[model samples]
Target: QLERGNLRTSWRKEHGHLRRAPVRASPLWNAKQRSVAAMRARVSRRPHRPSAKPKPAVSPLMLALVCCLCLFPPCLIWLLWRPSLGQRSWFRSPSPLPPPSPLAPLGEGNWTSALFLGDSSFVAAVHAAGHAFDAELVDERRPPLLVTVAEKADSPLLQNFLQSSILKHELRHWLVVALDSGVCEDLPDDVQWMACVSVPAQQEPADTAEPAMARPVNVKAQVLWATVKLGYDSLLVDTDVAFLQNPLPVLADYDRAHQQVRCGSAGAEPFLPHYPWLGAHVAESASTCESVIDLQAQRDEEHGIGAGFMRVKATPGGLLLLSRAMALSLKAPELTLQQSVSQAVGQLRGVITANTLPPATFPSRLVHLARPSRVFAYHQPCPKCVVVHSSWLTGHAAKVWRMKDQMLWSLDGPKKYYSDPKRKYIEYSNPSSMASQEAELNALKAAFMLGAMLDRTVILPEFRCHRCPTADGKGTTPKCSDMVTRCSLGAFGQLDLAKFAGAIPEDLFRERMFRYNPLTPKSAWGGSLFDSPVHLSFDSGKGGIGSLQASPEPGWEIQSSRAPEILSGAEVHPDNVLTPAADGSPTEDEVVAWFGSQTAPVLRFEHLYGLRPQFRHPARASAFDAMWNRATGM
Candidate 1:
């Protein structure tokens, strides 16, 4: 077959009649392509004809002039403005990632970290709170890291804050941004701290005419930026705050709703539920303006999120707010952190969404501190408050006292106070025999002073009142007492009581404290202490220690009097100073001896209405009067 084929092919080639192997066609296989190429060639060949007037060549000078004319303005502008270009970032570069945060290695799941600001002074507090969570048990969700910033490794304010938070809350995760050297050495090795040596010293605006980014609040803003930039949603909690319940869940719920609404409302009107950011003084009516941020700006500057207890998300709006606040703070050094944030929010209203924490869940010092009645009304049982911020008070000591009074203090030990077996407690009731609030108050004052002298924690008695302070705080509300207005302590009295609590050591008790104390003695349960828990057997309607037997006393008629009056054998004296001893009866030392003789864990008194302390030194009397005046707001 091969030979036959080869022979056929040869024959065909020789004869020029063999179906010659189909020759490859030209690349310009179509007539149209060939025609087009021919036309192009013909036109090229005929294009040598010169125009009647030939164009002149561009001179080097003219060319340079044209180029300069076109580019000079922009180049000059750029050169002149290049210095300011850094200030106006049209396209912001990614913020340099902070070295892995101390919070990263903690908790297993995604969790919001709690941020605190402090310095060297807070070292003790930080150490005390370092192991807020149990180390042995693995937490499915890590506790929020308590992050703080300080000017120096041992800044005083920061230290104070550490003390406050450590004592008040059992914090889990911890991270510290030590601005200066030695923090690592100062703090325990277990403490997770990052040294930020680059942080500039805080600058006072008065010292410099030009704005600087050295303000404490400004630095805080910068820290917030870095945190969110690292994808952390943080709870900015002041050290003064006390966690009654875990506030994270509440904050998380709000954040989830916030994100959901933001995501769901794309291309539609935003959902902004109005609540109080500062206090109830701000209006809650739905704003007519389309943007909530604008509405916030229009509201009083005093109103907005409380800087002390803020929930900062890592979302775009949150990041934008933080960045803008930081920039604004630098530009306007006079503005406070809260103010800068407000201004930034106003500017970013179009793109941002904000909501106030539910007041019922998160009560603040701003509203409750000024109005003591509200504190009791809404926060007494504190049925719903997740966290209580102890702020608006003047000093750290004052904040600590307030927390203790509210049964919110955690640093000393467990939440229970007056539980120490070594410590003694004195108990009394609103003298059922006394009819007037004034009489009852006098009794309370006497009891309080007596407790102080005895080194006992006075379990405060509930007042029997004809009228209670109205909820509005404007007037009295009548109780259902046979035709007369039956009342408990009035709002005014509560205010005075708050002052008293802040002024003194944690020596006095509110009914709630006694009722809530887990260590409350079984013998003390029968009395009608705020409707005793059903689990405790009730012996009588008398709450608290009312049912307990009164300590046996030979002489119950004790009256307070000045030493000079007693020494002079006279009743009247210029000084109001009174001793623990009864006037015309016993010496101060004798009085101490009498109380000291008692071996009882609790000394129950029938009533202080009739007992008048007899004598005291001038200094003692003055101190007593001061305490009395503060407690009564007289």
Candidate 2:
């Protein structure tokens, strides 16, 4: 109450009011009075002191001097170690490799190795020719040379390679290294080739009971190393590979990218270093190089990069890598070429780097054969592939047949034999179902015999199989993993049907039946039997079992719905009759007398299931047996 009264007096004095009107002692007025009294009491208790003078500001020079004093030791230490500071990179890039020395002329140094023996001059001349031919390409983007080593046994394959290159206009850039005289003779006179006797001619001496020096499982590396060291980059390919396109342009891109790649950069992701097959290749893809599985000696070793297709540069690293590989191959003769190269790469991992060609564009057999599509026919799974290495599949015959089916074959010099107008053909369909491969083969034997007897080329049907047969059909049976689920004629029996008995390729039916064939007019084809000539239906009497009479009485009949039109035409003759025989072989003269008078270009057999024609003559019987073996290999 006293505090409120004092506050009310102070307020009245401040307002200068003489009359003391009733003033409200609100909470705000009482609080202000207490704060004023507290301040007055604090002031009353304080001791009195004189004010001190302000100190002067420190100079900029003094401030800088103090900072220097604090940092002197560290700065001195840094200055003393300044030389080593620049060597450490903050961004973590790879250490730059020493620049390679300029390539010298071939014979300048001790270029001869154990593999090459002493063929320095010969190799130098070969490289000079290669450089000259590459210069003729006029395109600087192309690789320096494309090379392959071949012997007499690989003549067909060499022919195939040459033919493919000629088609793609890449023949001029090729440099074939011949391993023997036979290969040299097989090569065209105009082709750029050289004979290298680096490998031993004879494996063993006749007098020695002991084994001889084990020859290299593959001499591809030695040839490649010898050629690359001759001062030019080279693309080494196997003879079995079919060049679908000029691979030099694609390989040149790889080479350029490889040249620009650093040891540890984002640009190196798409590229692989030299000799990539250090261990087993896992999860193969479009960009990866394939590893060859060596099955020799039942080893089944799946190591080493495929030597079939390699793009080697002439850098010091490249030379060193090939050198080590050649040395390893020489030391370990039992190792396959792929295995030797792989071992070398494993040893020289840090010393050198190489680039692997993308297997998608340069496919091996493993990549291509695994495709569900018809790879050999339509170039499926890799139509844009530059080169298709048809390795892994054994035998030259298999390679030849596959290439022919793909229409990449020029062994016959680009002639379309399947569509020849002068040729007369016999067509037949496969049985509705076959119990086994043997059953189908028996049917094939019947067709082949009929073709030989009638002197007409038999058209093959799509041969179905549970598993792909071995290339020659005489090797080990294929595993279940090699089974192609669809109708594949490649798995069919590989025989010289053309030589033993007249036969055409499966191109007729493979290219959408006879419609795609040029010999058969497109307008005449109405998707009926009428599209062809007379459709002869043989009658085996009751129960589909009876002996065919030599005379033309109900032996055969025209089964086509268009039989009237066919009969109206003069193409069919009365003697053009044949029937399935139950017993007894027909004489050659009687058989000819029965069906030799027909003038039709295409003989359509409705169903030749039970038709088994046999000759009575001993000579003819012997010939037929030989033909049978060639057809079915039974």
Candidate 3:
């Protein structure tokens, strides 16, 4: 009270006579204060300002909401501008590798050793190729290429170094680390894929969704790991590849070794099957003949083939480095980390310096299995090539070196090496785009099949197959018989499935189905059922599944909605099985990848023989019946 009294007296003393002049207030301050008071008054009246543009008389709750909305615009723009730094990265540090140790004695200065490392699991193929060149399989305890797999899947470097066609380490002291591709790597991209009964093109089943899953047990990482662990040296080889003679006598010149690679050959598709047995690969002495069907072992042993031969000179330090790489790839938490392994080995020095004087087999060196009698025979009794790879265009590889014969080049000349005929804004030259197309094709096929099985229709934009056969006389013949043509499905509409059967690759489906499926029509099963035997040039055997005199009717509706697991095998008798679609596995991605890549038209010849219902398109009755009548020629 005293303080108030003192303030009142001071005011009275200063303004008692100040009333002579009227105090004029500025509109700016008064307006601001009034506005502020008005704002405050809003809370006492109503929470929202009905006159404000955005109804701004905000409540504590509404103010918070407006702040969030204003903030979102900038946040979303930032996200759009940024790239995922390590989102899909395959890079890793150097794998933990064993010390490089020599398998052969340097006492014989430069006397090199060659080892074949690949999916050469077939005992017959191994023995036939080994004995053919008087070569021996180094099954003795030795280290394989280093690798790791934290998650069960092949890393990038594993595919390029071991599962790919290029023989990066074709060493004199060779070591082959063979493994199954299906078990080692995710054969198909796991994303943008589905596993379900019905997948409508527009939307998918919401309640049950599973990630696209593919498991890879990398061959390179495993081999590198084995090499480090075993402490031995060897030359690596793919079971699908072959040699004219034992490379033992061929390692005289370089600091290391040299083997031919069909640079222009068709890149081996990762999903293809390979030699399928591990037990007798060495002691049996495989390379005795041309075709190695006898090594016909169980189906599970080799899910896919290794890329080809890689020559490694048995340097004491080399194995150590590889072992280190292997360690990084195969460690418990992360197995088959290929990028790390590759970075380590890529540190090794070398380049492709072709020998001035080439070998005879090289005159027509690498012959890719364009045809699907597809069992590869390594170093047949007398090898014709210094080396051969599993590349699809291997048949044309020799043409690159054959300066004498411009005629040797086949149609499939430019693989990853050459550019397609130019057209503005075309995608063949775009690796990134190509990958996307392949992904979409695989996704579409998967969706279509799943939808069909569930008696539903799936809409998909039309696309191209993985490969396409050359137009008649459309491609050049640089080699004797190899050929290729542009096959990106987007460029060309639906492929002539019959024409593309060879180039698109038939084994992914055929081998998977016929490996031990006694019910499959043997002769035409590996090849296209629609293709005539006379046109097939890869057969060294009595062409066709001649044994399929009578095939059983695989009981299923012409357009029945059923699970693949429902399909039973013929061996069990149609009446006594768990399902009708036993041939198809748990996921359809692999099947679709194979199907999408078909360069040929798909003709379920089994339908023609009345071995099964004629319809394959099960989405619509009208479509299925029309196809049935067409196939039956009704």
Candidate 4:
């Protein structure tokens, strides 16, 4: 995943109706992985083998050449010697430990108790955990932050879990939560976040036909709530989670200290004594909020525990240290806290733990962060997550299949069909007067496929235009230049970009790995990569939001066209039966708005609907989705 550069899309016409795209295969990520594997597979010592006999004689010419090479140091060095200086093994050395003292943090032979806590799924998961499902409800924010903020529709259940986390009585037992909806206002009491940009006038997607946008939206708050409450030692789980064998034995063992502290064990590894906190314990004082572990790392370095599958050591020492880490990590404004704790530990100087603990130990507590497979659900369960909850309705079946490859059994997938807009839990946005949802989705594809510009060989048969650039200020497709001839893929990405900059999509991302060892730094050319979702929403002027309703904007048209042929409402097996992701894109208009971050698009719609003073215009989910499918081969 190693890479660098700001890659964007640029399309050009080729042939009469087709255009070729350039998209090079990603760098040799596999080869780099093998390189790392070899490093890991280094043997303790070379294997002993029978000695081989030395060769006898060399020709006179060869001897003379060798003599000549020896006489000339530079030639001799080039021909007779290999360079070891810049290669992998000769003289690599780690810096000396200075700040944190070395100490044996954790080891095996420790003990722990187990517990489970979360929402409705908790009952089923607890049954799966081989434990009793029990916990009382308590409100987090007084008056409930949902109503307090402009969004009065926020759900109490989601609010409580997101801010407070599960109350688990089990030691080393984890709690889980799910993120089903969009984030609440990105606001936290502890951390101050400046406005990155004006929250675009809360825009709605094209399909949302209500007089208002849907209410009770808040994923960020839920994540923060679960994260800040981790001292209780619970892992958050998404509802669709499946389990493997009983994790009691593994949880118990995860609490011990590493027995080999002297063998280069450092930082938090010292704290994870094999049995608790991985066998490592914290200083007794770490139990208090006053203790602070300053964590520092490069911005490029990512360290955070996924909200799913967090673990705690059962021992008092392990719990104490974990609590300490949690206390400091909770300071992060976002819900991302785990990696923060790990980073903090890595930052410390090591006079402290340098004297203690080994780097790794046996039988690791494997907490599956994603969904588990089927067999585990049927036979036993693994506490991949200790608590489970979400911002919106958690996907039931997808959770099971998230990691199905490792599972032995499977659940009957959930039933999903062409949705009824009035159906609860299904959400949609409205289209703006300026752009169409279809236009926006296409814009996004234009941006994504921009990567196609890198490789000159691949082309899109759909693009059939060769309009030459014009000098006039007007921006419109040329008339005479109707179609194409052969064009270079590089011409799209590398040609004169200023002219089409506005028509180009700017928001693009690559997976995290592309920034690492495999791809060269120059491989990807976008800006930064994000782990969070970024979308453009349409806003017209409406308020009382509800998922099933339309945007709270007047003069807004959320149009949908009926399919030419009526398709049967039958389930499409594994796919439709399973209910694929609803994490949809911006409304048709937003796609057209891809010109600039803030600029709106220009397009016409027959009518508008939703918002105060509501007027009627047909805007249905099925119709819009149908139109969407036809416009883009989505």
Candidate 5:
């Protein structure tokens, strides 16, 4: 068996070696191999060629040029087609801003009637007087005939019509409306053909009756309702309001829109969606309430309605709105007429749309000429504003009348005051005493600041004075001689240079006229008072060591090229007190004197003109007129 196994293993090994060994080529394979070997021998026998060298590294300039070439085509295309692309259907061009629309013009036929109401006949008369002033300025073709509503027919206040000066100017048709008795008595001269309405008597006091329990019994509301019923569009102006410009033009736009009612607000707050009563409803709908909430917050920041000025069109919707408001007022006596109107309008959302005049056109605060407070100070009368409400100053009739006189003076006096050369100096000079001058200056400053705050374009007298060279050898400068006729302060120290700085250009510092000369100092050149680092170069013509130094106290510094030579005989001129050293350099004493005298004025200028006005602090008198002139573009 061992011999057989060994023979088998040897046979297997022999077979494995045979299998591992290369198989002998077939006749066709041997011929193909011999051909391939002959082809290789033929290729190797041919001449050999060197491989190509690697390409040199690309240059930065060439790379940049290639990159630019790649990017330029698209940029060029965009520039060429930009305008046309904007005009494409998918791309919307930015819309141009709309032009400002002017207020509509008011004509006689615009309103059927103008209703004037007052708690007392005197109050009504005062308002009518103010209205007369405004009426003269209006271009009404046929102004609405004035209608005055009084509490009683025989009220003593209305008895002496001829005796009153205000009534003599404007013809008013009186209507006696007994609110307590629900009796309205129309006068024989009633232009609208208004009839007396008989209202039912109330079991409770007339004031205590509620609209829900009974019909609304408010005379004001009744007057509004009756005006609408008569088929006449009405303008209800409270007695305390002074019409600055005619409001009919503003009302005409609303008339065209078919807007039932329009009201002026006491403040700059917006109306409509921001009504206080709409707050609850806005809170109920969170998803749709964002706009309403934003509007409410904005309006809340502004002032509410001034029911004193209202426009009611002869539309059923407007009448209904007024009626609803009247009913609400009757139910809630605590609420004001304006609040009632707001609440009623809130409830009747889509039924009535009330227009509101912009607050800029109908500012709430009256321009108080006397005792001007900060609240009234910044709220100067806007030239475009239709009315100025003085309801807050009702009890101060004397002050109001004084303000009226001042207004008249302002309107008429400026032309006369500016034209006469003889009066110019006196008018601009200190008025009688320092105290009075100071007061007048303060008043003028306040007026300027207030005008600026209100964004009113203030017209000032032009500065036509001659340009004078300053004492400090600077070029000729424009003198505020016409505006600032006299300085109230004894010395320049008291002058408020900062106030003057605000009105003039920033280069005021370099003007030599305002510079201080130690030997021959003059107050006219007030600019010298500020302490600024001025560069000075000294040329002795001959080379020598010179030094410039600043004093510690007055803080004046001088940089010199050579040491100053003390001349044995230095001539000092009377006008030019400064004596030049032998080396033509100013001595330390001369520099000190020049700088010391100017120190106060410089500091004052820095405090006044160099800085912003501290509105809360009282302004100085000396700087007031000059500053005013600057502000007004004089």
Candidate 6:
């Protein structure tokens, strides 16, 4: 008969949640009943052999000891054999593949790695890149490839990226925060690791102190070296770079060939050779090969690699190249990071197999969004370009504004048309082409619309007399006679009057005016036509009689004279020179006729506003006043 404890245990194993059932109706109970009846029947039918004195009932303790003896050896063997079985190759379950690393996952679809330095300015660039990425892939449903952005520990920019919606939406990933423990302290929770970099102390020249620009290069180099050591194929991107497409696919060819370093060009052309110039045998003794090549001479002949955007594999060779480059940067503090890296690559050409993206492919592949003049000379705008670096226009807001204007003009269908009626429109119907066109148009419209509104409403010029002489009498006093000359009319003739008549948005025109203003603060002005100073002097010998000088500040100086000088080549009116009314006031007809001869009077109006007194020539000024009042209601 089964022990109650054993029965309960067996029942529990089979159906742990169930309560024990009564044994009376069980099969085991029926079998026990039958066996007892059979034993009694056998005793009744046969003469019982004199039963030996009934064995003394086995003591419970003795029974238990016997049970232990039988089970112990097998249990012991099982304990030993089980572990041995686990150790055996055939018996053991396959060890589970290690949990994928969060930092660097290895797979065909694994995240693309990108590194950036600095904060606010770069953060803006990253945001711009994100925008471009969104625009480029709006219709596609593919998962966002992870992009790792690395910044200095305790960088405000890092905090911004962590808290930004850009990362939350899977558009970007904050993979690491690189720090120099000596220079910075405090690590945030969001990043996967704090990359500790040791920056060498700045060794300044005895003749002059170290340049401020050199410090960033040092920090960037050290961070890059540390990243490579950590086993990441890193793409070091400047804060000024924006992405229009995924650049990772472009590196596939190089990655497949096991190339250690792949660099983009600063100009339109690639600097490195097509195939490995040095064989494997030659690279083994790279130091000897370096001595044979004149790197400086090669750099002069070839377009140098752009350091702004470069990809370095995490292999030993890549790490060594980065280390060499970092050391070079520290040694040559005078050179830019790009120059230093170019020199390093040139020096180590034979030691390292590097590839450069072809120059012709640069525009269709990666564009350097530098100054328009610089970029336009080399980069041809197209839909296929993946990256843009706006670093060249960094602090120059005016240049940036002008770039926006150029983009708007490019997008504006009206502006693109030729005089030929046959070629009135360029139609693009392909989805990708349409998407790009729409994106550029949207960006242009978004950038300009707000400015257009403000220009039309808020920034109307207040027509107070800039030429009103102060009580000190130090500056020129405005006179009505100044307006009567043909020289003044000629100056007025040069102005674009339609610009102020709503042909150009007031804000844009104001920006243009402010750019022309010598006294306008560069920080305050949004744009400028002349990047540098332009000297202009009046020639009294010609039809021009006014003496004007640009101040170091934004305002201009016009020499006022009571007796207006008669210019030698001044165009004379056939009817009358002055054409003044009996009341010494210029008639409406005379004012109208004078202004009608002018082409665009916007600049001329500004000039007149600056040169004339507030109450000077009430009748003659009425036309301007009416126009200004009608447009601005001021």
* TM-score of every candidate: 0.50, 0.58, 0.25, 0.23, 0.31, 0.34
Worst 10 residues of 5 by lDDT: 292-301
lDDT of 2 by residue, 535-581 (tens): 22223222111321121122232232323332233233332444324
Clashing pairs counted in every model: 31, 2, 124, 155, 22, 11
RMSD of 1: 28.1
**Which candidate has the highest lDDT of all?**
2
TM-score of 3: 0.25
TM-score, candidate 1, is 0.50
Which portions of model 6 show Cα errors greater than 4 Å? Answer: 1-171, 174-214, 253-303, 363-380, 391-399, 406-634
Lowest-sum lDDT 10-residue window in model 4: 138-147
lDDT winner, 1 or 4: 1
Q: Which scores greater on TM-score, model 1 or model 3?
A: 1
Best prediction by TM-score = 2
| Ranking according to TM-score, highest score first | 2, 1, 6, 5, 3, 4
How would you encode candidate 3's per-residue C-alpha lDDT over 1-634 as one tens digit per residue?
6896687678879889756444466889789989999988877886554564554566889888999999988866665543332212243222222333324322212211211222234222222222211122222222222122222122222333232222333422222222333423332333111110111112111221211111133334334323332343334443334343344434332211111111112343212122122222322322322111111111111212122334332344445444444334333324333344344444432311111123233221222222221222211222334544433332222212121111111212123111121110100011121223334443334333343433222322223223333332123232223221222222233323333333322212221112112221223323345532111122223323342222222321122233222222212223222222433232333333323443221212111011122134345545644543442223
Off by over 4 Å in 5: 1-218, 254-303, 366-381, 394-399, 402-634
Candidate 3 Cα misplacement greater than 4 A, ranges: 1-219, 225-231, 236-308, 313-315, 327-342, 346-634
Regions of model 4 farther than 4 Å from truth = 1-241, 254-307, 314-335, 347-634
> Whole-model lDDT for model 1 versus the true structure?
0.49
Better of 5 and 6 by TM-score: 6
Tell me the TM-score of model 6: 0.34
lDDT of each: 0.49, 0.50, 0.29, 0.26, 0.35, 0.35
Better by lDDT, candidate 4 or 3: 3
